[model samples]
Target: MSNPQEPYQPVQPAAWPAEPAGQPGNPGQHGAPPLPGNPPHGAPGQYGAPGQYSSDGPFGLPGQEPPVRNRRKPWTILGVVVGVLLLAAVGVLILVNVVNGATNHARGLADGFTKLVIAGDSSKAYDDYLDPALHEQLTKEEFIAGIKTLKMDRTCKPAYNQVNASTENGTKAADVAGLITCDGDKKIDLAYRFEGTDELRMINIKLKPQA
Candidate 1:
């Protein structure tokens, strides 16, 4: 009643209630700082456990950075794949060249030896064409006599139907079979096995007239 008459004084507001001691949200008593290793009031604090990491990162928590990805891994894998393909291509090319080379070598040996035998040069043909193992089986004279017996010495150009080569147990071998036209319009079927690769040597031969 006395205050209302004396200039109508305004009433002061009540102070806020103090937070309880040891409570997490508030600072210490008298607005002091929080203890060591403790976080500020109302802070979210660290999201994950210490020393814990994820490979599949881009951590879900806000404001956190993910682990750096290995940028070179994909490129490394690509390089390896390309290298394998190139090596395979090289291998196939080498194999094809080897097969073709063997064929050509066998053909040259056959043609040269056949020409020598037909021209009646038995000494040169036997020494150059026949394998050493074959020399043990037949003398040079016997081989030339056999050729005369078959009348192959009168033959001309050959038309080979099959000429194939293979490598087995580290040994290269080839087979050639074809028809040869004789001087009298007669035909002879001739087959031969040539051994070795770089310098072919004939191991066997067979000749027969058309049936």
Candidate 2:
């Protein structure tokens, strides 16, 4: 109060050497920077030991290794291989059943046609099972005459033993080959070829007599 008239001289604040650890002289800063794998000062939780880090969270906190997960087991790989093999076996079994069914049906057709001609019922055999192509080439009388030339126009029975099915021109076909046992122990080794469609018809015929 006594120096009020002496002069209006004001005292200045003291300057720091390096701004302490962290404060304003910087942008949006507060205290000192924390050590690695540790939160900043004033955060909860105790500090870790030297060169040690927390591994409580996923993939660790920041400086820790991730968890160890084992690879696939041997039993798991074996199960997959067994499953594939079972499926393939089932497919092969189904295929075999279908082929056997087709072959049996084709054998039935062959049995009917051959028995009819051998039993001297040539007209019915030719009209029912012979193809239109054969009809155009030969009359029904000629067809019967052809059977008679084989000495098969007699009362007889058929013993067709084998048949196989296949595909031809996008249609089902079959071949029936077997022995035809007639009356008096006469055996004719014969094969019949039939082509596919909505109906069964003979495409070719072969016969050999066994004396």
Best by TM-score: 1
**Candidate 1 lDDT over residue span 161-193, tens digit each:** 788988887678989888888788878788889
> Model 2 RMSD to the real structure?
10.4
Where's the lowest-lDDT run of ten residues in candidate 1? 48-57
In terms of lDDT, the best-performing candidate is 1
Instruction: List, residue by residue over 153-183, the lDDT tens digit for candidate 2.
Output: 4555567677889876778899998887767
Taken over the whole model, the C-alpha lDDT of each candidate is 0.78, 0.77
For model 2, what is the error of residue 94's alpha carbon versus the real structure, in angstroms, after optimal superposition?
1.6
Give, for candidate 2, the lowest lDDT window spanning 10 residues: 41-50
